[model samples]
Target chain A: MKGFLRQDGRKGIRNITAVVYLVECAHHVAREIVFPFRDQQVHLIGFPGCYPNSYAYRMVRQLCTHPNVGAALLVSLGCEGFNRAALLEEIRASGRPADAIVIQQEGGTRKTIAEGHRWIRAALEQLAATPTTEMGVSDLIIGTVCGGSDATSGITANPAVGRAFDRLIAEGAGAIFEETGELIGCEAIMAARAARPELAPELLACVDKAARYYTALGHGSFAPGNAEGGLTTQEEKSMGAYCKSGNSPIDGILKPGDVPDRGGLYLLDVVPDGEVRWGFPNISDVQEIGELIACGSHITLFTTGRGSVVGSAISPVIKICANPETYRRLSDDMDINAGKILEGEATLEEVGNEIYAKILAVAAGAQTASEALGHQECSIVYKSFEPTGPACMPA
Target chain B: MNTSSPQLLRLHEADNVLTVLSTLEPGDALHLGQTVLTVGKRLPIGHKVAARPIAAGEKICKYGVPIGSAVCAIAEGEHVHTHNIKSDYLPTFERENQHSYFQPTP
Candidate 1:
């Protein structure tokens, strides 16, 4: 497959120019700047917090210089606590065409929007001249997240994704699965699959931390619709969600923005390290998708039984439906009908191979159902975490 | 499609509950191990049915693991849901008493 090669040697399936708003105050202007280019590969992403956060800073920096991003235009209100200067410097260091527009310094909204338009137009031209390189399966990093889960999710889509993940890892591609808060009861089994014996405690500890954090908040990641769809308990829901990891040995633990250095299976710990300072770890599925993108996932495999129609800004999302009734009702929003396994129309291996084939097709520039429907949802919220321990990623 | 195909699926041999493959109405006959049982109420697709007689506080097994415990004694072919089961880890959320699924133990 052909891919957009960055100066840092990372390959991306999609080369997009991102317009980032450093603060909530600059969001309107950033949106207006990307409005005219919305039909193209330009997208608007931002952090809404007025206060500074280390997690948000790292996330924004990683996103601005993501392999999928060709260039970036930072929109700052000029007074927010976010370190826009450092962010711009990091993007520039990555060899991407980077520029920043401070609204306070460049007059008000009108002038700043106009300047952003000019910079983005020029950046697009430079990106058009960027070189392309041949990419292999090993160059790809795939992530999986299950949203709107039901009982069928575990029986069909989730396990199918696990099959696809195993295949990707065997072919030398990096695969990541997350939502530690949802994997409450499966920690023991998951820990047993760690690549090294020392990494077992790290895996178990993260899940234990998630259980404690959620108990403090008086909620697990269990949603109302989950119970509505025949999922009786958090652990039951977790068992289904855990199947998305496949049976691959865990390579390492990753916080939101920590990119894996090698090709293997990694678990993204979405739960914050410290006490629950932020209201919730992730407010929506889009936030998790953003975190996965920041970790260099070129494409996300989103499995759903209740039907979530969200797609990210930088990367495309392939929606696999688990329930046949839901699939029949929302077929247009779904890419693969994994419900066939339950209906006796297909086997898990067949659907898994189909998902694996779809990943290659999307990497080669095929639009997923959500992408073709113009879904570019994104979000980043306040959160904090300490760095991973030495044994978290054993060599 | 085979019209006579069993609609109830037992995911694992040790699982005490079977998943409903398609919606079944009251009085629909279900072929359990060596015995035929009739559905007493409407069971929707993806819902669970007790594979055998289960006592109160017995672990509700699915995927060969305990998802929760039975809140009340459940007969074979009975619907197993929030009304009859409780999570061992966390409380399941329901919308402002809108659904009759969960009943507080008095």
Candidate 2:
């Protein structure tokens, strides 16, 4: 498929402008800036906290320079801790035009919005002029997450997605599986699949971090809706969720904002390492999705048994329904019905092939069901993480 | 499509329970195996069914891993779920007083 060529020699499957708010106070102005251009590829993302966080800054920077993003516009409230200047420099360095407006200095909301339109117009024109190059499966980075999970998830959709992940990794594409909170059980098995057997300790430690972090929060990433769908235990749920990583040995472990330097399987440790001060890690699925995108996932394969209709801004989410019953209830929102494996109709490989093809199609500029339905869902929260040792992702 | 029919799915040979592939009523028969059993109760598609009779406190295995323990004696083909099982790691987070699911013993 044809790829959007960025100035840094990286290929992008999409070319969209991102409007980011440095803090929550500038959200209104940021929304107004992208409101008129909503029908196009404009997505709004930001840090809601007023306090400065290196993680948030780095995450925003990674997202701003994502292959799918053509340019960025930063909105500041003039007093938040987010490093707006550095962020602007990062986006510009990627050879993408970037503009910023401080609400206090830019004559407040109305004037900022008016001038924001001018900047967006110019950014879009400049993005349209970016060169196009041919891209293959190897250039793509895919991530998987299972939500609204039920028993059918492990038996059907999750494994099928796993098979698809195997195929993608075999083709030299990057694959990421996350939500250690969901992986409460099955840490040993996961560590066993580490590319370097020595990396097992770090792998186990991350899951340990999730277990402790969740224990303190009085939750385990288990939502009320999950139990309603027939998942009796967290280990059962994890066994179901774990299949999304396929059989590939994990090349390394990654934190939410750490992009994979090369292609292979990597687990994102969403839990913070420090004391439990900031609330629960990843308040919802969108936070996980946002993290996946920050780490450079061009598309996410979202499997659901109870059915969740959420697509991401900047990245497309291909919904794979694990329950036939749920698929019938929300067929329009689903891209694949893996529950057919239980109905004695389709096999796992068939569904896996379908998912792989769907990824390719989505990467080729086709909007997923959620994207077409305008489900630009996203969320990012405060998190603290200690950098990994050299063994985590050896240079 | 009105084609959601009941079927039994066994993910691993070592699994002591089979996932109820579809919503099933009691007294269903199958040519499943020599462990010859029939559905003993109504069960949801995603719920678990005993592949064999499991004694009280026996580990309930799925995906070839011990997910929980049977609180009481469970007969072959009986619907194996919350009523009969308890998570071995941590309490299964159900809508009803659901807590955390634990990590496996390292």
Considering every candidate listed, which one attains the maximal DockQ? 1
lDDT of 1 at A208: 95
The digit string of per-residue lDDT tens for model 1 on B6-26 reads 788887777899888988888
TM, every model:
0.97, 0.94
Clashing pairs in 1: none
* TM-score on B-chain, cand. 1: 0.82
Chain A TM-scores of all predicted models: 0.99, 0.98
DockQ of candidate 2 compared with the true complex:
0.50
Place model 1 in a CAPRI quality band: medium
**Could you tell me which 10 consecutive residues in candidate 1 chain A have the lowest summed lDDT?**
A386-395
Pull out the clashing pairs in model 2.
B94-B98
Candidate maximizing TM-score: 1
Best by lDDT: 1
Q: Write the per-residue lDDT of candidate 2 for residues A280-327, one digit (tens) a residue.
A: 888788988989988899899999999999888888899999999999
Q: Candidate 2's residue-wise lDDT over B1-106, tens digit each?
A: 1121246677777888877677876776643465555666667778877778899999888888888789999877777777778876656565555322344435
